[model samples]
Target: MELTKGANAALDAGDVEITVSWRATAGSADLGPSLDVCALRLGADGKVREDADLVFFNAPSSPDGSVRHIGRTPDGAGEVVTVDTTRQPADVASIVVTATIDVVTPHLTFGGLAVSARVADLATGAELARFTPPPLGPEKALVVVELYRRGGSWKIRAVGQGYASGLAGLATDYGVDVSADEDVSAPAAPLAPTAPAAPTAAVPAAAAASAADLPSTGDPRVDMRKRLDLRKKTVQAVLTKQGIPGRQARVALALDASGSMRALYRAGTVARVVERVAAVAATMDDDGTLEVWSYATEPVALPPLRVDFLADWIPLYVRMRKATTGQGGADATLARERAARAAGWPIPNWDAIGGQNEEPKVMALILEHYERLPSPPPTLVLVLTDGGLYRDKQIAELLRRTAKLPIFWQFVGIGRARYGILEKLDTLAGRVVDNAGFFAVDDLDAIDDETLYQRILGEFPAWLRAARAAGIPL
Candidate 1:
């Protein structure tokens, strides 16, 4: 359906994609306006509650992960944003999609540019609505379209509202705290989308510092400090009780994103789990950043978790997979496998990684990550899973070989499941010292932070002492 200014269309699809397109040469400059697409997640009061509510190239995903600035269209003339309405919070009454000229690319305006926006169902690739605004004059930013809730259903409207003040004005109108000097450029040099973990290197002996000496977080974002203060306190208490209050380690988190664990992911359990684990990193990591990976058949390296954007990180990555595996079982799965090989999709392959559990592959990836570090600090790897461990021999071999290394594996079983070799990590033979621990919780969300942290760090101190005694470089 084509929509004119002020006209609206009903959105029946659960997941919809918004593509804003314009003529590549529609600007006064050679590169055109250099538009940056963004979304403002607003509360019922029609204002953003926080700065994280603005999704753009810098912060690609909203805090809850309901809305994301996916990327530019292949042609470079358009940008795409995805919205999952079912996952959005009830308080989010609307999501306003806008485009602005990159502040760095000055002297460009929307004068006489032909701009159009389309809304489509992501699953079906069918256009649900389209909007073509009238030619503009001197506007540097525009609210092209908006997805809003009405009578418990979603609807999209063609806004075509012009903002002469660029991004700061549009953001300020929606309640985002924009300062004068902030860089509001679109598509700033983007970080590697694959994973947030930087090249892991061993922390030099001279550089090792206790958790107490580390700052609240390495990221300079001050708001995150206040957000993480309480949880850091809880983690500190647990570390103190475990007799390692000041000890530091490079923290790594591995999450299970298999099909069977979909329930946990959908219920918002995974996000809470990340917060609990992130608190541990905040207190115990040398740099206070949590290196992270998500695995099923293969492990996907994710962006390292920072206390600064902790609320937004979980949803952005955790829900990266599709909502369902396949409707037709084996045949459908096989067809997708073939299609994936031919399509060469740029994003992470959700279907391949969501099919089954494969621990050794991810374990190797994590192991190689830390081993590459020159003189690494003692590493604490927290592995979260909810399924069975059928590859007993492979897992045991990997653990036995790494026993002498300054690495400890803490296998946390999330739900009731058969954990074959994990239950016997304490008894595994041929290791220089006990380098692993296993614990299970039937209800992860129900567990308090203090107890969870205590149980998680229960065996780490013992392993640290033994590793030091065995002549391993501390």
Candidate 2:
């Protein structure tokens, strides 16, 4: 259905890509007048699930392949905030499309710019709707249009609502806590390993082993049934500090799989971190399942992980990392990797996942899959990195954009490489709440589980309170 300014239409839209695009006139050539498209995914109550649902240039897509903003070159014009209605998850009741005057641009408003937008089907490139509202009074951003659910049918609303205070105000209405300044803290000194633990007698790297040779579940839980009274003692002791009792949330790990992380992987440091995270899973997760993902050239999800198999996982993983090429693919070796514990050999997906770290793509892939969930859980993605983050502006924008979500991002740097960008994450501009935190540890093993858990949990409580208060679905 075609829509005029302020008109609402019952749309025949479904599972189609709705591309929102806009460009302003040149009266303000000297001043920045870029058009930014954003998608605000509403929950069942016609409200947002959390900031995670808001996808834009910063966070380009959701975890699931559902909603994504394939638009690039914000000001260059063309399609922006493309929506895949078919991929849109059920919990996301409405997809609000917005176009705002670039926030970073100074002294620019709708009144000074000539802007027009079109919503077209991506496949056909057919214009479904268009809007050219009258000159604005004082607003700097416009809720250009809304695609929502009505009577079991998707409908469209030409919202045309303007936020005089600009993106920040629109963000506030959408549950973003923009009032809070970006949270910043001095980067902690990196943890240093004292001395390598005494080595066991050297054995041929090619030796064979079997699954029976592996250890039992290290978790104190009775086979991962419940989260009550069963976490590891040290994990439980650490969590008892009580700023808040743990609540069920989706937990995920983004382990750096770059070549630089080779040493850590070989040393079994990755396995140890997994164990510590399992202890955390025993607390905050319902079924004790942890979503595991690792990134090198790009991001890839791994099978759900439990604490039991995590033992000797890295060593087994390293064993497959032969000087030869075909030696990879850990999934193929899971049976062997498991048998390799007794028989020691198969590593399938592990060989294909890591390389160069693309932090932006890493986050985009995670957010995409999360949005695909039937009901996205309040998420916590622990990113363990061995070095610096090159795409600062991109990652900074993502953290700022998703700050309203019931998700907290923690970055743990393990190597000597300076985490210069991550250290100042809290100071990035345009953020709602401090959605991300960063800390550096020179050695992964040097930090105790309690200390690791403590550092990870630090800003979590405040984020919970802020997100809930902002009306974001937790």
Candidate 3:
């Protein structure tokens, strides 16, 4: 169906690919505008919930994996965004397909380009709708079309909305943190490791035997099965399935305490995560204790938690604790400082270490902590975050350094915010052995234990063999 501006068409239940094509105007400048096609997954509020909701060149796929920018068309005339309505999150009400010109010259606009977009059923390869926007004026960006939820079904609309401001302006209107775009760079090739490549293929049974059967370090009275909660037991099973059964490792938990994570903390989701990861410690750690830290601008070392003390851990450390401060001036500051020190807390005036994302600082601290130990065990650091990671280069360097050590960083993205560097760990290079893995879950409370465990340990076992082969102590 050829759709005019404002026209609509019903969509079937399946993956629909939106292709946007643009060409330079006749007899224009030799250099054409750098056209970038993007898809914005909007919520019921008509705005994106987070920066991850916008799928573009930088962020190729949505966190839910429903919306994906499939790159330039086969002929290289346009870009395609595949919308899997079948997997679309309930909160996503619509996906707006937009096209923008990377302005290299002053006052560049859509008038200099001829742009059109089409939607087709990905399965059958049948064109469902096509839209040719009217001639635009000074707008540098245009919302060519939209695939939106209609009751139980889906529908497509040709929304020829123009934006005089460029991609940043248009994105800002949709609730994306455009400020992050400035610090963000296009996904680059991962750094090459200086060391020799370790055996990455699944290790033979005999080779894995030496590293198997971790010593039982916990109390002899408490049964292992009885110690772990159901969810943690599932984690243990997953570890076994991944070929690292009964392997001992020091476990650490790093929780995000940024402003954006306030909701998760308030809903007791963060506490639940602590409970779950503590199980990993129970199963793997020497002392059956989990080292804990909460971070935003800085990392706050909290009291270490054990399976037995988990019941009281959340209420005391995980839960937010507010204390009076500015109202009483110097006396208040002195009082709070003394009180915080007496309680063994890190800082005097603390708000869960809540502020902006300074991942490198906390990461450095974690690295230093383990480095100080005489002989640290193979450590599994589970960094739970809700996205907003911008220090990509620093993080890459740190991971590279960590590759030579016995530490494995398993970064779990808690929500659908832009994960930036964490989302691109697979492509990261310059490591003796790949020491990091990442996966995002939309809702922690809703995910089944089996699937969560599987994802958590997906790359760990392989890393274990590889690490040992590289002569890293485990």
Candidate 4:
């Protein structure tokens, strides 16, 4: 690429044009022909302009080829000549041009500063096209223009401007500039050096260890199950210590009946974990008031909360888990599960749980219940499933919406699957996520009965303290 500006005393009429050219190169080696070209230009006004072209070149005989002239044309207002390559035996070497100081607008301020600018293409409507103005002060300003291409059209993207207060400033403030009536000249002598030889390839190292070496299962449900059980027991203990009967704190065990739960059956860990948590939550109170609801595509209240409702909710959990495994993939299963969980829940509309995906929908359901349920005791939502969420924006939005709510999001990652997204929600790092103080637990496969029990017991006091700080009536 070559950009040239006619030299004249007058600055305004000085026209600038750029030409881009290319050709194939030949050499002693039997290597294929190659094309050499440059997409940079320097104006007579001490300004720089560069452009990149998606050039299509023919095959070359050798890697090291000779420089050959192709064709040229006048670019900016016919001031710069650009060459085009036709039939060259060797690859085209490069395109070169001189730089010039383009335009300087003084005594003008925008957003609190004086500005001067220029552009490679004069057709642009927006000023400040190639450069930004210098800082306001008693000094001379020098601005540089650089051009390139993006998408379909050409663009002058960067600007380097400076402000100084002495003789250097005078050169910048009123120095030699490009003239208007200057004509296009023959291509200048190529000042840039020839291309160098290509580097040889290096060998790669051996592969690393596989997933078998990892410490835990990647499934989300294992983590969810352990965390839920831990949270329930902790809440019960805290209530017992406060002299508040455990029966008084109503705990609802909402399970996702979505098809994805089926994946857990194949692993065995998810079904067993769910069964244990349900049994524990059901036996928490003597009145047998533990309600189990299953959802998928829609909510189904099971072991109904009506004092008369009694059968094991575990079987239903198992059934749902078996239905989703290895069939429609995890994402599909999770979507079904989210839909069912949302349907089975009380209060909050299904829309709040989101119309798509399990995690966001579960979050929506939690927020809805928190808002609608009458000053209920600090409720613990033990969402048991694989922590596979499909929508990132929805999760962020839900977190923001529920930031003020007194709900703790405990994500239990089950199996040997990865739960990187869930780990991000853990609040131990003092990073208040989405303005919501929620934490998560991962690696359920590693927890023992004693550790699991103690962890659940530990959550009560931490949550209670958080609730107190938030002024939530317990």
Best by lDDT: 1
Clashing residue pairs in candidate 3 (N, C-alpha, C atoms within 3 angstroms)? 192-430, 193-430
What's the C-alpha lDDT at position 43 in model 1?
Answer: 91
Off by over 4 Å in 2: 1-231, 312-351
lDDT of 2 at 289: 56
What tens digits encode model 2's per-residue C-alpha lDDT throughout 159-227? 555666667767765665565553221111111111223334533435412111222233222112122
The lDDT for every candidate, in the order shown, is: 0.75, 0.62, 0.72, 0.35
**True-vs-predicted CA distance for residue 314, candidate 1, Å:** 1.5
Model 1 poorest ten-residue lDDT run: 186-195
Candidate 4 weakest ten by summed lDDT: 5-14
Q: Which RMSD values do the candidates have, in order?
A: 18.5, 23.1, 23.6, 29.2
Ranking of models by lDDT: 1, 3, 2, 4
Off by over 4 Å in 1: 1-227, 324-347
lDDT per residue for candidate 1 within 1-474, as digits (tens), equals 998655566897989999999874434444554689999889965689788889999999987788899988888888999999989887888889999987766677776467899899999999999998765666788889988776578888777767666777677667788896864432110111211223334455455333222233223222233335656877888888888886888899998877778778767687668877888887787656799898988888876775534533444455425643332233443444454334221235565675578999999999998888888999999999996889999999999999889999999999788999999887899999999999998998777666788899999999988999998787
In terms of TM-score, which candidate is strongest?
A: 1
Summarize candidate 4's per-residue lDDT along 1-474 as a digit string, tens digits.
Answer: 211111001111112233222111232231221112222223322222221211112221112221122222332211222222222122222223212222232332121232223323223323222223222222222223333222222333222222332222322222223343332211111111112224324223232121112122232222333344444555455446544434333445555544445545556555455544443454343222454544454444443332111111232233453344422445544444454344232222322221222556545655665578776555555555454555555666665555455555544444343444555554433323223222334555556544453454345456556666766566
Give the Cα-based TM-score of candidate 2 against the true structure.
0.48
Q: What is the lDDT of candidate 3?
A: 0.72
lDDT of 3 by residue, 1-474 (tens): 897655567886489888999877786673545678899999965699888888998899988788899998776669989999989888888889998876555556776777888788999889988988766656777888988776477888776767666676677667777676442221111111112223244545454322112223232211222324455567778888888887778899887777777667766688667766777786777556789877788788766665543543444456333332122233444454454344333442355465787788788899999999999989988898889888999999999988999999999998888889887898898889889999998998787557766887788889989999999988
Candidate 1, residue 61: how far the Cα is off, in Å: 37
